[model samples]
Structure formats: structure tokens, C-alpha cells
Target: MKKYLGPILFFAVFEAVAVTLWLTMDHLFYLFNFTYIGGSVALGLVLYIRKWKYARLMVQLAVGLYMLIYLGILSRENMQIEGFWYYLFLGVFEAATIHYVVAKIAGPLLFGRGWCGYACWTAMILDLLPYKTPCGPRRKLGYIRYITFGISLLFVGGLFLLHVPDLEKVMFWSFFIGNALYYGVGIALACAFKDNRAFCKYICPITVFLKPASYFSLSRVKNDTEKCVSCGKCKTVCPMDVDMTDNARRRKNGTECILCLKCVEACPKHSLHI
Candidate 1:
């Protein structure tokens, strides 16, 4: 029962969001969207608890492909950061706006960067690259994320400032091209850095929102010292370079944790848990 609590809580949270949005916005899509995502995540959690190796990747694809293909392409809703800005400026409280509020922005306060680990379409493809672990020390280039974030804001702002005609079409095209650019750069950086998460660590504009809210995340990996032998396997396997051994909020790369559970899997002493 205790072990199942994590999945139950996550499903409940997402369901609450689903019901609220469905009732308030008068859209059944919200109910369907969040329910599917929540169920996928809950299933993944159950698989992880059962020691399934590809549990995280399974969730990543189930959610990521659904968003990228069904919502973004078929339904023509831009779920990207640029789309969030586009919808926000139009004072439209649907689609990307609601998505950002629930997933990337305020949602991080509860789940940390779990979205990055289990549901980013960009990262879903990037994670398939050969470099599962970083080859060298983390670089000082994380400042690049801020630059990218600013660029996204300015790009959308420029379109509105210029009063571009046929704005919806342009936004849809931007969503298409922007995802292409992300995949191109993300793959190149991953191969260059020998790190699967290089783009996530240094270039993802969403991190600007995810990091601050995630700093106070209620769900986090913790190390139990009483059960511990100081084997450094956890650190070696952590994709985000988090020091999960330290339970403090200010631990090294603490906000960067995506809750991927590689650290937990690698802990021979079984001292790590959420």
C-alpha cells in the first residue's frame, strides 16, 4: 500500500486538474488529455516499482508521442513554449496556456522536473542517443537556456508587435519548425557532449519555468543514511548529475533532478527512494 501511494497521489493530482479544466473550460478534451497522461504515468510508476527496466522510457513515449502527434499535429494545437506565449498574448485560456500552467509552470512545484524525464517529446528522442551518462563534468554553459528562453519570448512578441496577418498559420508553422530545430540542436549537442541530456541541461527554454518551481518540489529522491554503504553508483548513473545522496533542498544540482530514478536503480545498498 505504501509503495502504491506514489502512483495514487500522482493520478489523483492530474485527475483533479482534469476535472477542474473540463468543468471550467467546458471542454471534454482536457478531461481526456490529463486522464491519459496521468494513467500513463501511473502505469509507469507501477512498472518501476516492479523493477521494470524501461518504465521511464515507456511513459516518455506514451505521453510524448500523443502530445506531439495527436495534439500538436492533428488537432493543430501548439504545445510548445512559443505556443504558450502565443496563446497568452491572445488572452486565450485554452490549449497551450492551460498546458503551461499545469505542466511546465506550477506543476513543477509538486513533481519537480518529472515532465522532463517522462514526457518531453524533444527529450524522448534525445534519450535514445548513445550517451546515457555524461562523459565529462557539467559545463558552465547552462546560461544558454536563459538566452534561448529570451529568444522564444522575443520571437513571439515580435510577431504580435508586427501584427502579422494569418497569425494562426504562422504559429502552427513555428511549432513545426521549432521542434525540428530543437531536435537538430539537441541531437548535435548530445553527440558533442557525450551526454544524452545535454540539450535539457543547457538549451531547453522550458527549464526557465521548470527550475524555480521545481526547487520546492514535494516529491524528490532521498538517501537513507542508516541503510547506506557509500558506494558512488548513484552519482555515476544520474542523467541530470544530481547529488541524490544529500537530502537538502540546496543539494548540488537539486533542482535539475528529473526523477528519472537511475540513481535509485543504481543504488546497490537500496538506500535511495522518493
Candidate 2:
């Protein structure tokens, strides 16, 4: 029962969100959507606790494909940063805005970057690449994310400011093109840097929102120094170069942790946990 507590708690939190939105918004889609995503995530956590190796990948595919193909492509909901800006300018509080708030913004205060590890459509594919861990020291190109963030905001703001015609159609097409660019750039950067998360480290504009809230994340990995041999295995396996042993809010790259648990698995002394 204790072992299953994490999954139960996760499911309960999402269920509360699902029910609240469904009733308040009077939309059955919210009920179905959040429930499915929550169920898949809970199932994955259960599998992970059971030592199933592919549990994370399974959840990523389930949530990523649903959001990317079903919601983005077929249903025509753009769930990207551009889409968030597009809807924000239009004063629409549904769809992409709601998603960003839940998954990337406020939600990180509770779960950190769990969405990056488990549900991001972009990272879903990137994680399948050759480099599960970084090959070298982190680069100083982090400033790129701020630039990309500005570009996305400006692009959408430009459209509204200029009163672009057929704005709905434009947004739809932008979603397609933006995802293509992300996938292309993400894959290329991964191969070039020998790091599967290179794109996430330097290019993803959503991190502009994810990082700040996650800095105060209630859920985080901690290391027990008494049990730790200081062999440096946790840092070696961390995809984001997070210093898990530090147990400080300002630990090196602390905001970059995606809760992937790779470091936890690599810890030889069983000193790391969330």
C-alpha cells in the first residue's frame, strides 16, 4: 500500500483538476481528456514502481500522441507556445491557455518538469534518440531559450497587431510548421551535441515558463549523504546536469530537472529519492 501511494496521490490530484474543469467549463471533453491523461500517467508510475523499464516511454507515447495527433492535428487545437500566445491575444481562456497553465506553468510548482519527462510531444521522440545521457559539459547557450521565447510572443503579437486575415487558418498552419521545426531542430541538435536533451537545454521556449515555477517545486529529488559514497554516479547519468546531491533550491541546474529518475536509478548506494 505504501508503494502504491505515489500513483494514488497523482491520480487524485489530476482527477480533482479534471472534475473541476469539467463542471465549471461545462465541457465533457475536459472530463475525458484529463482523465485519460491522468490515468495513463498513474499507470506509468505504477509500472515504474514495479521496475518496468519502459514505463516512462509508455506514458510519453500515450499522452504525447493523444495531444499531438488527436488534439493538435485532427481537432485543430494548437498546443504550442505560439498557440498559447495566439489564444492569449484573443482573450480566449480555453484550450492552449489552460494546457500551458496546467502542464508548464503552475503545475510545475507541484511536480517540477514532469511534463517534459512524461508528456511533451517534442521530447517523446527526442528520448528515443541515441544519447540517453549528455556526452560532455553543459554549454553556455541557455540564453537561446529567452530569445526563442521572445520570438514566439512577438510573432503572435505581430499577427494580431497587423490584423492578419484568416487568423484561424494561420494559427492552424503555424502549429504544423512549429512542430516540424521543433522536431527537426531537436533531432539535429541531439545528434550534433551527443545529448538527447540538447534542444530542451537550450532551444525550448516553453522552458521560459517551466523553469521559474519549477524552481519552487514541491516535488524534487534528494540525496542522503550518509548513504552516498560520493562516487558521482548521479551527476553522470543526469540528462539535464542537475546536481541532485545538493538538496538545495539553488543547486546546479536545479530548475532543469525533469523528474526522469535516471539519477535515482544510477545511484549505487540507493541514496537518492524524490
Candidate 3:
């Protein structure tokens, strides 16, 4: 019963969002959308508790493909950062705008960067790269994310300032091209840095929103000092290079944690738990 609590709570939270949106937006799509995503997440959590090795990967694919193919391609809704800016500038509360609010912004307060670990379409592909754990010390190149963030803002703001015609079609194409660029750059960076999450750590603009709220994430991995034997296995396995031995919210690279649970799995002493 205790192990089942995590998935149940996650499913309930998503269901609450689904029901609220369905009633407020008068659209069944909201209900279906959140229900499917929430269910996938919950299923992953259940599988994880059962000690299934690929549970997280399964959830990533299930959610990522649905967003990338169905929503971004088939439905022609750009769920990327640029799309968020486009929708936000228009003062609309739909599509990517709502998505950013839930998954990238407010949601991080509760779940940290769980979206990065379990659902990001970009990471869905990047995680497939050969580099799993970081090979070298973290670089100072994280400043690149700010540049990318600025580029996204300027690109979309430019379109609005110019009052471009056929905006929807343009946004759809941008979605396709933006994703292509992400995969290409993500792969290239992974090869160069020998780190699977190099793009996430250094290039992804969404982290700008995810990091701040995630600093105070209610659900995060904590270190049990009593159980720890000073083993460094957790640090070596951490994809984000977080200092997991430190339980403080302000621990080194704390906000970078994606809640991947790699540290927990690596700790032979069972010192880490989420």
C-alpha cells in the first residue's frame, strides 16, 4: 500500500486537471489528453515500484511519442517553447500555453523536473544515445541555455511584431523544424560531451522555467545520512550531476535533478529515496 501511494497520487493529480479542463474548456480532448498522460505516468510508477528496469523508458516513449506525433504533427499544435511564446503573446490560454503552465512551470513546484525524466520528447530521443552517465566534470557552458531561451523568445516575438500571415501553418512547420534541430544538436552535444543529457543541461531553454520552481520541489530525492556509508556510487550515476548526498534544497546542482532515480538505484546502502 505504501509503495502504491506515489502512482495513485500522481494519477489523482492529473485526473483533477483533466476534469477541471474538461468542464472549463467544454472540450473532451482535455479529459482524454490528461487521462492518457497521467495513466502512462502512473503505470510507469507502478512498474518502477515493481522493480521493472525499463519502466521509466516506457513512460518516456508512451508520453513523448503521443506529444511529438499526435499533438505536434497530426493535430498541428506546436507544444515547443516557441509555441508557448506564440500562444502567450496572443494572450490565449490554450495549447502550448496551458502545457507550459502545467508541465514546465507550476508543475515543477511539486514534481521537480519529472517531465525531463519521464516525458520530454527531446529527451526521449537523447536518452537513447550511448552516453548514459556523464564522463567529464560538468562544464560552465550552461549559459548556452539562456541564449537559446532568448532566441526562442525573439523568433516568436518577431513573428507577432511583423504580424505574419498564415500563422498556424508557420507554427506547425516551426514545430517540425524545431524538433529536428533539437534532435540534431542534442545528439551532437551528447557525442562531444560524452553525456546523454548535455543538451538538457546546456542547451534546453525549457530548463529556464523548470529550474526555478523545481528548486522548491516537494517531491525530490533525499539522502539518508544515517544509512549512507560515504559511498560515491550515487554521484557517479546521477545524470544531472546533482550532489545527492546533501539533503538541502540548495545542494550543488540541486535544481538540475530530473528525478530519474538513478542515484537511488546506484546506492548500495539504500541511502537515497524519492
Candidate 4:
């Protein structure tokens, strides 16, 4: 029971959000949607605790595939940064806007980059590549994320400003084409940089929202300094290159942590945990 407590509390939090949104928005789908996502996350957490190697990957697949296929493709919701801008421009509080708030914005305060680790559809595919850890020098192309973020904003804002015809149809196609490009770029970057999360490190627009909020994340990897032998294995396994051993919110690449626990697994001294 002690081992399962964390996931239970998370489920309770999500359930509260689910019910609140269902009542406040007058939409029962909110209840189902949050429940399903929360359930998948909790299940994955349980699997991880039980020492399942593919636990995080399974959760990523479950949540990412549902959002990509059911929400984006079938329901025609973009669920990307561009979609957030499109809906925001229209002053709509539903769908993409709501998703951006819960997952990419406010939620990062609690879970850090859990979305990047266990939910992002683009990263789901990227994580499958050969390079799980960075094999070479990290590039200084982090500025590209800001450029991509600006491009997403301009793309949607420009369409609205021009009063484009069949806006909904355009957004649907944007969802389709945007995902294709993300997959393509993510894969190429992974191979080029020899790092599974190369695109996430340098080009993900959503990180603009994720980083600041996640800087204060409640559920971050922490180091037990008293127990640490300082062998430096944690840094070697970290896909995001987070210096988890520092145990400080201001540590280098601190906000980039995805709560993946690879550092914890790699720690020979058993000094890291989330």
C-alpha cells in the first residue's frame, strides 16, 4: 500500500479535475477523458514501481496513441501549440486551450516534464530510436525551440488575421501535417545528434511553457546527498542531461527533467529518487 500511495493520490487529483470539469463545463467527456488518461498514468507508475523495464514506454504509448489517433485524427482536434493558438485566437476555452493549460502549463508545476516523458506523441516515436542517451557533445541549438514556438504562433495568428476560409478544415489539416513534420524532424534529429531526445532538447515548442512551470515541480528527482558516492553514473544515463545529483531547483538543465528516473536506475550509490 505504501508503494502504491503516490499513484492513488495522483488518481484522486485527476479524478477531482475530471469531475470538476464535467460539472463546470457541462460535458461528461471530461470525466471519461481524464479518468482514462489518469488511469493509464497510474498503471504505468505501478508497473514502474514493480520494476517493469518498459513501464514508462508503455504509458507513453497508451496516452500518446490515444491523443494522436482518437483526439487528433478522429476528433480532428489539433492538440499542438498551433492548435492552442488557433483556439485562443477564437476565444474558445475548450479542447486545445484546455489541454495546453492542464498538461503543458499549470500541470508542469506538479509533474515537471512528465508530458515529455510519458505522454507526448512525438516523443513516443522518438524514444524508440537507437540512441537512448546522448553519445556526443550537446549542441547549442536550444534557441531553436523559441523560433519554433514563434512560428507556431505566427502560423495560427496569420491565418486568423487573414480570415482564412474553412478555418476548421485548415486546422484539421494542420494537425495532420504538423504531426508528420514533428515525427520526421524528431527522428532525424535523434539519429543526427545520437540522442533519443534531441528534438525535445532543441526544438519542442511546448517546452516554452513546460520549462518555467517545471522549474518549481513538486514531483522532481531529488538526491540524497548523505548516501551519494558521487560516481557520476546518473548524469551518464540521463536522456535530458539533467543534473539530478545537485538536488536544487536551479541545477543545470534542471527544468528539462522529464522525471524519467533513468538517473535513479543508474545511480550506483542509490542516492536518487523522484
Candidate 5:
């Protein structure tokens, strides 16, 4: 019962904020966007400090589902903005700037990729996905984010350098189908790969963008090697399949980390610190 208190309190706070935003704002869908990222971060902070698993999971589901509905299925107005060249430039610039600032402040100063664990909308959805993925003994899969990052960069750059006047027409038609496919494929992959956050770990372009930015984030997951019993709970609970123990042991920071704080909460011996 004590374990459930923190989550319940956090959920109440999150819902209150959402209702306030909805009542006050003209564009309620925008609130959905803000809630997914902003609310997740706030909840993650509470969970990190309080070590509440249920609260973390609750925030994960609420924020993740809202994002899917808003960004993926409900409307294409947001994606429509991408059709304009200036809007596209500004959007990518703003996104990159936010990613860089948040990552730098969170990664080095406070916790490594802690932002990814809590703040990323993509990670939020991946967290709610119920399945387990195979954790291979090797660390080769960690490089997938780097490849994704490169591809996103190329896509953004191609849009800027190549003057494609018909891009918007193409995008307008593609948006609905593309988003549906994306969500469908992501959910299917989650069902297939039970252990890891299949979509977040291997496919999300947003994660690719956030990885470099997270390097500069203020917070990070820290480990107390001495207290660690090597139970591997942190790794088991990790949606991204990151070996928190290995990461803690090496003190090596990577862009793949979402900073959801699951590893911190999962450490039975309190070996994982954030």
C-alpha cells in the first residue's frame, strides 16, 4: 500500500495540470503535446526522488497514449507545418536547440540521459509497451541510435538543400498513412520484442535527435559499485535494454539513454543512483 501512494499522488497532480491547461487554452491539442513531454518530466522527477514504480508507469501510459493520439492518429495539422520550407527549418532548429540544451544540462551536470528516461515522448510510449526483449550478452545494439541519428540529420538536411516544391502535397497525403503505419509498426514491434523498447531502441528518429542533446543534460544515472549485488534488475526493467549496471560500472554516457529512472527504481540494493 505504501508503494502505491506515490504514484496515486503523482497521477492526481498530472490530471489536475491537464485539466487546467484544457480549460484555459484555446488549442487543447497543444496541451496534449505539452503534457506528454512536460508532464512526463515532472512525474519522472517525483519518481526519481521518491522511487515510485507505479507512478512512473502511470505517467508513462498517460503521456505516451496522449502523444500517440495527438501526433499519430488524431490530427495532421502539426505535421502539415513541415510542408513549408521556412517552417520546416524553424522546426528542426527549435527541436535541435531544445535537445542540445536539455541534454547538456541533464547529462553531465545532474544525471546521464535522465531526460530520455522521463522527458522523451517516444520513451514514454515505449515504457507502456508490455513485452520482454532478448538481452544479448554483447553491447552492439547500442549503436542503433547513432545510425538513426545520422539518417534523421540527412533527412532534415535534404529537405533544406533540395528544393522540392511538391513536398507539401506529398506530405499532406502521406501524413495520415505514414503516422498510422508508424504507430501500427511500433506497437507490433513492441508486442514482438518483449524485453526491450523495440521502437525506441531501434527506430525512433526523435530518439536519434535526443541522443546527442542528452550528452549535455544536467542529470544522469549513477551507480554505487560497492552496493550493487549484480542482480541485473535494472537491465531487466530497462525498456531500451541498456545494461545500467554496465553503464554504471563504466561511467560511460551514451545518447541511447532516455533517463526514465526505471533503473534507479529497479535497483534492489540501491546500487543504481540518479
Candidate 6:
């Protein structure tokens, strides 16, 4: 029961938040757009104090609610079939605003993309999924983010250079289709390749942007090397598959780190203190 509890609780929270947002769309719009300045305030607090865990959870909840409102459910209503290009622009703008600007800039600079671990709708969903891999020898592949970044640039640049009006139509259709494909592919790869977060490391555009920004964050997971036992529990529990033992020994945070604090939580000898 303890083994399954984390994933189950994650799902329960996700569903509760998603359903609540779905039911209270108007209130969310008011809070997110006008009334609530909580996010910015929270960002400042986290940055000033280096409160990684609290900050991460707040941003995560905010972003998760935003995603539920914008992409998961409400998006169906807002999508315009007739003015496809206009709708595409709206969608792109929204994604950039939330993922790149808000999450990447405010969240990462303050709390090191803790939102990736705590708040992202996709990440939250992924966290709930069952894993077959016994946490084992983990490796860091930070280069994969660069590849994803290049592809995102190409996709955006190609559309701009080609002056493709149909690009909007294509992307509009892709909103639903692309999301399904990403999740489907992520699940398949996780099951087959045993990479717990293959999509996050290899394909998420938000991650591509956030990883670089996170380097400057004041709130980061740091390891104490001198405390010493190199048991690899931290590495195995890591969804991103970063070797926390290696990170602790080296006294450096791996770029692939999502700042999930699973490593901090899993450390037995108190050697892998974050």
C-alpha cells in the first residue's frame, strides 16, 4: 500500500483539481486574469527565501489548474473551427505565455522548474502512471533537451518562413491530436524502454526552455557529499532517471533534475540530503 500510495494520491489530487477547475471556469478566469496576484507574489517569496518545496507546490497547483482550464477541458469550447489560423495563434500564444513565460521564467528562475515536478498537468499525469522498472543505474542525458529545443525552433520558424496559413489549421488540429500522440508515445516508451520520463527529457518544449533558466535559480536541490553512503535509492526513484548518488558525490545538480525531491525523500543514510 505504501508503494502505491504516492501514485494514487497524485491521481486523486489531479482529478480533484481538474474537476474543480472544470466546474468553476468563470471563477478561475477571474482569479487567474484579474483578481489573483498570488502567483507573482509566490514567485517573489520563493526567490527571496529559497523555499523550493513550498514554491514548487504552489506553482504546480497553479499551472495544473491553468492547464486543466486551457488545454484539457475548456480548450474544447474555446477552439475555433472556422477561423483556424486565428485560433492557432491564440493557442500558441497561450502556450508560450504559460509554459515559456510563466513557468520557464518565473517558476524556474525562482524555484528551478519545480513546477515540472509539482504542477505541470502532463507531469502530474505521468507521475500517476504505473512503472515497471526497478529503480536502477540511472543516467543523465541533458543533451536531449537541446534536440527538443532545436525541433521547436524549427517548427515555429518553418511556419513563419513559409507564411503557411494552413499552418494554423494544421496546428489547430494538432492541439488535440498532438497531445494524444505525445501521451501515447510517452506511455509506449515508458513501458518499452523503461525510461520513466522519456517525453519530459526528450520532447517537452517547456522543459527545453526551463532547463537553461533553472541554472540561475536560487532554489535548487543541493547534495552533501561528505555525509557519504552511495546507495542508489535516489537514482532509482527519480522519474527523470538522474543519478542522485553521482550528483551528491560530485556536489552538483544534474541538468536533467526536475527538483522533485524524490531523491531527498528516498535517501536512507541521509547521505543524499538535498
For each candidate, give its TM-score against the true structure.
Answer: 0.98, 0.99, 0.99, 0.99, 0.60, 0.62
Better of 1 and 5 by TM-score: 1
The sequence of per-residue lDDT tens digits that candidate 1 reaches over residues 107-139 is 999999999999999999999999999999999
As for lDDT, the candidate ahead, 1 or 5, is: 1
lDDT string for model 5 (1-274, tens) is: 5654544554554455456656665447534654556556565556645655576556556655554456434543333112223344656433224224434333334445544454444556555665643444333454665665465456546865887666545455554554565567677866665534666666655555455545554445667889988887787666565566764433333455666666776788988764
Candidate 2 lDDT by residue in tens digits, 1-274: 8999998999998999999999999999998998999999999999999999999999999999999999999999999999999888889999899999999999999999999999999999999999998999999999999999999999999998999999889989999999999999999999999999999999999999999999999989999989999999899999999999999899999999999999999998999999
Q: Candidate 4: which pairs clash? A: none
Per-residue error at 106 for model 4, in Å? Answer: 0.3
Off by over 4 Å in 5: 1-40, 47-52, 65-116, 119-125, 132-175, 246-253
Give each model's whole-structure lDDT: 0.94, 0.95, 0.95, 0.92, 0.53, 0.55
Report the alpha-carbon TM-score of model 4 versus the true structure: 0.99
- Per-residue lDDT over 89-195 for candidate 6, one digit per residue giving the tens place of the 0 to 100 score: 44644423433454466557655766667666566556556762324444455466577556655665666677878664555565566556667877775665566
Q: Which ten residues in a row have the lowest lDDT in candidate 3?
A: 230-239
Clashing pairs in 1: none
Lowest summed lDDT across 10 adjacent residues in model 4 is found at 240-249
**Candidate 5 TM-score, C-alpha based:** 0.60
Model 4 Cα shift for residue 36 (angstroms): 0.4
lDDT of 3 by residue, 188-217 (tens): 999999999999999999999999999999
Off by over 4 Å in 4: none
Residue 198's lDDT in candidate 3? 97
- Positional deviation of 138 in candidate 5, in angstroms? 6.3
Q: Give the TM-score of candidate 6.
A: 0.62
**Residue 43 Cα positional deviation in candidate 3, in Å, after optimal superposition:** 0.4
